[model samples]
Target chain A: MQRVNQTLGRIPPWLIYGIAAFPPVWFFWLGLNGGLGVEPIKELEHRLGELALQVLIATLAIRPLREWTHVNLLKLRRSLGVVTFAYVSLHLLVWLVLDVQILSEIWADIVKRPYITVGMAGFILMIPMVVTSNNLSLRKLGPKKWRRLHRLMYPVCVLAGLHFVMLTKGFQFEPLIYLALILVLLAARVPWNLGRATA
Target chain B: MAGRYKSDLKWSDVTPKADWINRRQLMAGSGALALGSTAGPAVASLGAQKTDWGAGLEPNTVEEITTYNNYYEFGTDKGDPAMHAHALTTEPWSIEIDGLVDQPGSYGLEDILKSVTLEERIYRLRCVERWSMVVPWVGFELADLLAMAGVQPSAKYVAFETALRPDEMPGVSYPIIDWPYKEGLRLDEAMHPLTIMATGLYDEPMPNQNGAPIRLVVPWKYGYKSIKSVVRISLVEEQPPTAWNNYSANEYGFYSNVNPDRDHPRWSQKYERRVGGGLFAKQEPTLFMNGYADEVGSLYAGMDLIENH
Candidate 1:
């Protein structure tokens, strides 16, 4: 137990990669167990939405939790953002495989469902973050350019949360709580220059 | 006495001991149980109670009477009863039946089962929140027990409560939903042929979260109306308050009818994704009254369904 605690005290980047791989592990479990029932595609779609929401929330939570609790989980930040990308990709794959079972139908759903449109936009915006998350890209882009480029996460989180809230037609209290938490976390990170100094 | 109870059972054909033990262990720890087919040996072990009535369902190897469930002490979740109800002292279970009943005393679970001639009924369970299951319930009609108890004409509705034990059901420690879950149906709904005070399922006694001794089942209504782990049954003149309504009045109304046309503000009620149906099975269109309209439709006649719903 002491050894385990000691190991946890060290921040391994592979740990982030391992944590990032869990959505696929869960997807595999769902596939193996026949847990998805008749709606594997639909379940897959919902799973993506949930995973995206979770990753987005985790990404938004990093700065606040770090400042408040002072635990440097910063290594997890980029990886969690990538996991969000992976989940969103899987969500899109299910649509291709089960839903529509055809490309035309997939295109039609993307056009018809406004929620899908917003989700697609969120996924599209995430490509740059995932591309730039690498150490190689960080060196080429430099800290100033990389930080500015990653600012896209804010609108992506907003669109993703809104996509979830809008898709749920009734009063789903759980999603409301998620939205509230994300807003507070995001609000806490407002730029200093944006606020007027009190005289 | 144990031999007499076990007379109908064939131990060899019982559910695999390992599986039953594991399930019992899991169910003992969890307050709710999952819905699935049970093996034969398990059914035989659970089906030992003497009963003159034939099970309404065709007995199958994997079919069992008492399914695992997850109804937390505070409320029912599909998985709750199996996960959180081990500490519930169901052995000394007693139900207080009063108000408009000639017999208004507490009754024990053992006594209640012995008195009723348990029958089997296969019914499609439609949850108000929009999931469904086809269950073979092993118990007499609620009216048979109510008639024996002698309900007065003034008894308009029947209200049921689950015993609230916080120490056993740790979920109650947090206020997610109301404790001591309550459900009600019109007297007519209670006495419907389809409605049952289920004692067993698949062939065994109900697990603790499945409402061990007794629970209500109104097939026409959403699953919530079928209260589990019942501790009280009171016949009232006015429609009493129900659990879901208390939680969200606008979302879950008192008359939570099974209407395919009336969509939940959040989701479509036009169709339902059956809980156990495998992939590629099209979501079956939800029926107006869970396909029990012929039996229960007349009961609500002349009343505005939109208003009540």
Candidate 2:
């Protein structure tokens, strides 16, 4: 675990961002070229959303990994969160521009559809986290306050998971598993967080 | 009970389980979607005379119609049916026709095909998932099928059932839906000329994912109303159960008629994207009865469609 931490230290956190940036481009290229299948817009929209959820899961996993395994990937967490936000934004853009393609349905859906409401709320919550992700904001607000604001990710993650669960037609297990995994990751941190606060 | 619906099926008869998956990967590798049919027979292209139905609308490409499907017996993903359906053995298939019909017995597919005259119907299929497709189907009318069976006066509805081969259909193994997917129509809707039991598209034999052998195609209703891979047709007095309606009674109704004013809780609304319209295709306004209201609107003249939905 120490060796893994050392290796992770040497790998710049920007490298994760750089690598994460490539998929949206690759997926967009696929969308343009018919590689995303017959209904490329829908596939592209779903793929981006799934990627966002997976990246967000990776973000949530970081603290647990450091606590349990003694492998610190603290630097990569912020980068991963930023990447997740970008993918979420892309996912929203695809739905608005390509999939739905109507301006009226945009606000109407968020109002009418519970899943869309949850997803939009999640995306809105991400805005503050993304804004505060920088070192400037970290220093301006100080670590304690900055950390408190960023814990908004907990609700964001929950809402994102709920969004997926609600949108599915049948009782699909995949989205439920994602929601379960997120809850587990969040629950695992509660004891450690309480212990640290008391200490 | 589901075990009763499982046919003697093996992927080995089509292509080795390992090989069929590889075939999809290979097709996916070769540019776009060259998938969906390799596991089944070499599609025989027929040259049936075209009908005036859906005359002005351009039919979507065969690839779009076959590759993007919602045959949940195979899987829920639109492409799932195409990817996994080819393994189904549709040849020598038989459907049990009973319940208030004069001739109540198992009828073979070959015999049914021989009895009915084939016609090309290019119809717009609006799915409950907010996507639409125009398909050119070659098959006979359900009214004809009902006529051949001789419906009794007591029969007020026509209930349909999809072939449930758990060995072949992987989705059937999942508890997502009550197995042996079912659908129904009022006797009048069943007898409507527009309601067809499609055997093929693009003059080719039905692709497995698109409901091979014989499938219902109700142009005026949401695509799910048009059940796939039909194995049973019963003329009953009471309204029979439908797959979506059984899954979620509030969301998916028995009528399931396309109404632009009606909105699904999540997926549907007044708008639908026409597949094969390329990326950034503007969503067209979903039509009432999917633009077949002129012919079939009187059928539901008195009922509240939104309540039914």
Candidate 3:
């Protein structure tokens, strides 16, 4: 565990950001090259949403991973969170500009569709977390309030999972598996009282 | 297969070279006046028919047709059918036509084709998923096939069932929406000229994923209403249990017509992204009955579509 921590600590945060930035770039390249299949916009939107969820899941795992394995990824958590927000925003933008492309229908979809409503809720909740992600806001709000505010991730994850589940045609198991994983992670944080723990 | 027929015969030339040879062999062997007499007028009319239903829209590329599909029995993903459906055994296939039909029995695909004529029908396929495509399907009208089976007056609906082979279809393991996918149409809708039994696409035999061997294509309704890899077709009095309706009664209806006004419970049907139109392509406004209302609208003239849907 000590050796793992030492190795992780040695890696620069910039390197982590560089590695994390690859997916969106690769996905865009694929989009430009006709690699996203027949319905490229749908594929692009789906991929962005999936990446956002994956990054969120990874960000949520950082603390638990440190507690269990003693290999701290605390330094990269903020980067992961920022990347997740970026992907989520891109996902929304694609749906708004490229996919739907109608102002009235977009509003109607977010209001009418249960899945999109949940997804928009998640995105809305993420705004505060993204706004106060830096050290300046962290210092201004203090550690206690910041910790409380950040705990909103739990509900955000649930909403994201629900969005995924409801988007599918029938009772698909894939989205349910993601929801289960999020629930297990959330459960792990409960007994430890890690919500109060500082990064 | 016999030599390829000349191209100058127009789209109405339903007599493929192999069928012509088979007809000659049957005539020489048995002197079957009964079969010839019955088939003569139908063949003659088919030969004279020339219909361009696509209006000027070019058919989607063969790559799109072969790759993108919605055969849920194969899997839920669009690409799943293309990957997994090749495991299906399409040869030696037969369809069981029963219920209110006079001649109710398992009929071989070859025998069925011998009696019917194949025509090129360019159709706009609007999926319930809000994606659309134009496909040039090669087959005959479902009404002709129903007539061949001799539909009774008691038959109010036509129920179609896809073949189930859990061993070959990996999607069946998930129990997505029951084993064999099923769909139904009102007797009038079934008899509509737009409802066809598609055997080939892009002038080629259908790829396994695209419901190879035979499938139904109802242009007026959502694509799911057109069941794939049909193994059984029954003319019944009651509306049969459809797969999607059985899965989610509120979301999927028995009729499932392509109406832009009636949004799906989860998503809007007002607009559809045309497949192969690239990422930045604007979504087209969905036409009522996918633009086939001019021909099929009278079928539901008295019924409230929203209530029926």
Candidate 4:
């Protein structure tokens, strides 16, 4: 585990970002090349949304992974969070500009559709975290307050998972699995107090 | 059977068998040619005819028609059917027409086809998911099949069932929906001229992904109302259980007619994006009864649409 930490520490944060950036670029290339099958726009939107959720999940997993396995990937969490925001923004932009072109209908969709309502709420919650992701803002707010503010990720992740579950037409297991994973990660963070005796 | 109802067709309306068969053969042969091979003469000799039903609408490409499908028995994703439905075995198929029908027995697919003439019908298929497509279907009217089976006067509804072959269908493992998807229509609606049992598309046998062998095509309703891989057609008095409605009665109703005025509880029904329309294409306003109100609107004259929906 210590060796794993040493190796992870040696890998530059830019390399992680570089690797993480490939999916969106590849998906766009697939869109341009007619490789996203028949419903390309729908396919692109689904892929972007899924990637955003996956990145957010990865960002949340970093601390738990370090706590459990002692392989600290703390340096990569901020980059992962920013990438999640980028993907979430692109996913929303696609739906707004390409999928639903009518301005009036867009408002109706966000208002009328429960899944989109929750999704929009999650997206709105994420804006502050994205704004304060940089070093300058992180120092401007003290470390403790900054950490507290970023805890909004918990609700964001839960809402994003719910959005996925509601978007499916029928009872699908894939979205439920995502929701389960998020819940499991969140459960791991609970201070069980059973370890208080040892402390 | 011959004297029951007059066909809404003239002698000249039917395409010549030889030419129709040749066109289908040519299409199949061309596909084989693209793979750097030639189809056998047997496959190259089938008949097919192209019909123009949607006058101003162009049919989606054969690739689009075959690849973009929603056969939940195969899987849920749009591409799932194309990737997984190849495992289905449609040959030697038989359909059981039971319930209130006078003739209640399993009928071989070949025997059923011999009793009817095939026609081309280009239709606009609007999915409840708000995606739409124009497809060229080749088949005979469902009413003809029902007439052959001798529908009993007591029957008020016609229920249809899809095939259940878990060995062939992988999606059945997930229970995403109850197995052997079922659908139903009112007796009059089943007898409507627009409702057909499709056997082929693009002048050839339907690709497996697009419900090979036989499928229902109720163009005026949301595409789910037109169930695929139909294996049974039963005449019943009470409203029969439908797959989607059984899953969620609140979301999917029994009479799922396409209506711009009634929104699906979760999504807008006012507009739909044409499936093959380019990425930036504008959404089109959804038409009541999917633009077939002139033909089918009178069928529900006194009933409240929102209540039935």
Q: Find the candidate with the highest DockQ and give its number.
A: 2
Q: Write the per-residue lDDT of candidate 1 for residues B1-309, one digit (tens) a residue.
A: 111111232333334546645544544222123342222243554453433222222232221223324364523333444444555766788888888999998887778777766765556777664556666556777777787679998889988887777777766765656766788888888877677888766556665656666788777787777888788989999988887788777667787878876655544566665554444434567889888787778988898876678
Model 2's alpha-carbon lDDT is 0.83
TM-score of each: 0.71, 0.91, 0.89, 0.90
Model 1 regions more than 4 Å off: A1-22, A34-50, A61-82, A89-152, A155-184, A191-199, B1-70, B74-80, B279-281
Q: What fraction of the real A-B contacts shows up in model 1?
A: 0.14
Question: Could you arrange the candidates by TM-score from highest to lowest?
Answer: 2, 4, 3, 1
lDDT of each: 0.67, 0.83, 0.81, 0.83
Q: Is candidate 2 or candidate 4 better by TM-score?
A: 2
Docking quality (DockQ) of candidate 2: 0.64
* lDDT for each residue of candidate 1 in A1-199, tens digit (9 for 90 to 100): 4454345446566777687688767875774455543235456567776877887898788877767766656666777788778888877776566444545545755776677788789889999999898999999999999999998998888888877776652234566777788888788887656565411
* Model 3 stretches astray by more than 4 angstroms: A192-199, B1-50
The better candidate by DockQ, 1 or 3, is 3
Ranked candidates (lDDT, high to low) = 4, 2, 3, 1
Of candidate 1 chain B, the 10-residue stretch with the lowest lDDT total is: B1-10
Kindly report the docking quality category of candidate 3: medium
- What is the Cα-based lDDT of residue B274 in candidate 3? 79
User: Candidates' DockQ values?
Assistant: 0.19, 0.64, 0.63, 0.59
Clash pairs, candidate 4, are B20-B47, B20-B48, B21-B46, B21-B47, B21-B48
Q: State the TM-score of candidate 1 restricted to chain B.
A: 0.78
Q: What's the TM-score of candidate 3 when only chain A is evaluated?
A: 0.92
TM-score of 2: 0.91
True contacts kept of each: 0.14, 0.63, 0.78, 0.59
TM-score winner: 2
Residue lDDT tens for model 2, B1-309: 001112232212222324534434555555333455732334455555545555467677666777788877788888787778877998888889999999999989899887877777778999888889988788888888888889999999999999888889989888888888999999999988788899887666787888888899999898889988899999999999888899998889899999888888775569888897777678888888898888898898888888977
